[model samples]
Target: MDLFPPDKILVDRVKNGDREAFTTLMERYQQKVFQTSMGFLHNQADAEDLTQEVFIKSYKSMKSFRGESSFGTWIYRITVNKAINQLRRNKLRAFAGLDAMKGEDSAADTNADAPLLRKEQKEQIKDALTKLNNAQKKVFVLFYYQELNLKEVAEVLELSPKATESLLFRARKNLQKELD
Candidate 1:
């Protein structure tokens, strides 16, 4: 009747020195981690690197994994914090161009206007996102890009559900103002 093996079983196995169980756990969540990283970073290579760091940190911090939350939520918190830290560390270098995360085609495209039009729109949105404070940005990214539910976003943000809702509302208002 269970959709998947319980995380506790896998965690116990991992703690008991079962390397395969750890591998299985990583396989199960790697894509989710990667996608979350991509949403935060917007760069495939950086996302991949952050994904690896997330798993490595998770493995090292396994002792702190109390079953209070799902393994997925715990891993997500770690991923979010690390990704934010990486952004902070490289803010000057990465944000200097503001196009570093965006892929550019060197060859002239046949449909030039369309590509330029979309890139301009995306740049507008990215500029709007940059206006958000870290907490607002975190909530916005998790809710929109990561497609996490209100409850999930609350858990990831470590905020009460009501507080998370308020944060999301304010983030939306801020974004709307920026874009408009």
Candidate 2:
């Protein structure tokens, strides 16, 4: 059963000091936060922990949420920032433990297999994406995977639409080069 009618309803309830309403908001958005984190961190445990942190932080700051943007978008922005920070830390740690991260060991899923050229293509894409600079990767993921339009992407990234477009262009060029 749904704990609240909708996010807006819950947001109003939360603004009125209803903890349960806030919990509902967390429940509704947790998987999205986790997936967003995973797209950057690529580790289940870390992603899960970060998702939890994102909600906790959001809940604590709920009083300040003055409906500037939709609550969902605000939460998404928080999750992305948390994920980016983790990615930065991960890059630093990568140098310290070179052996463990090698060849599928640190990949998001250590599953069995998918088959054929599509699987190869998927792997290639993942590899290419990882090679992108952070700014380019951010635009690529937000635009391509999250399906945000250029304007929405700009809002999230705090970039001009033109800058976001250029980042995406460079990102795609880099990916295509890596794939070839």
Candidate 3:
């Protein structure tokens, strides 16, 4: 007897009104979803919120899943779309000066005593990522931050493998230019 069923089985169970099956799926994918969300939003609180939102949306739309792609790929597509939309909303808030009212420091608040060089590198990378076009940024984040392979990134982005590779190449080149 298997301790854990496959994602396809769990997905079917969720579609058939099995709430526990959905929870099992959530436990399996939540970390990856959170990490992917953080890769785009660059804020822990926002990423956590986005993670919850992604699962809620997925749960509501479970019946629409066609299984054309793997469950992981489908969930990742949702995470990416939600994260992009959140980024757009954040930009609008910043432009309106509402973000300043939140009184959140923009600096890396993860570690106070971290080495200066490491901190600067992280800032530089984050800045460089902002400069990328949306396609390049998506490919870069999915491939590097989410640790998805080229094929998986292609599947999630609904791009051909060659196209995904091209975007990743461009992203790396742009980042190099910005960092240098």
- Highest TM-score scorer: 3
Candidate with better TM-score, 1 vs 3: 3
Ranking by lDDT: 3, 1, 2
Model 3: per-residue Cα lDDT over 47-91, one tens digit each: 899999999999999999999899999999999999889888988
Scanning candidate 3 in windows of ten residues, the lowest lDDT window is 101-110
Off by over 4 Å in 3: 101-108, 115-118
lDDT of 3: 0.90
TM-score of 1: 0.83
**Per-prediction TM-score:** 0.83, 0.79, 0.93
Which residue runs of candidate 2 sit more than 4 Å off their true CA positions? 1-6, 98-105, 114-124
- What would the per-residue lDDT of candidate 2 be over residues 1-180, giving only the tens digit for each residue? 663487777888898999988887887888777777767766577779899889989988888988877787888788888888877777767767753655355443544465556556667766777789988988877776577799888888789999999999999899889989
lDDT of model number 2: 0.79
Error of 1 at 134 (Å): 1.1
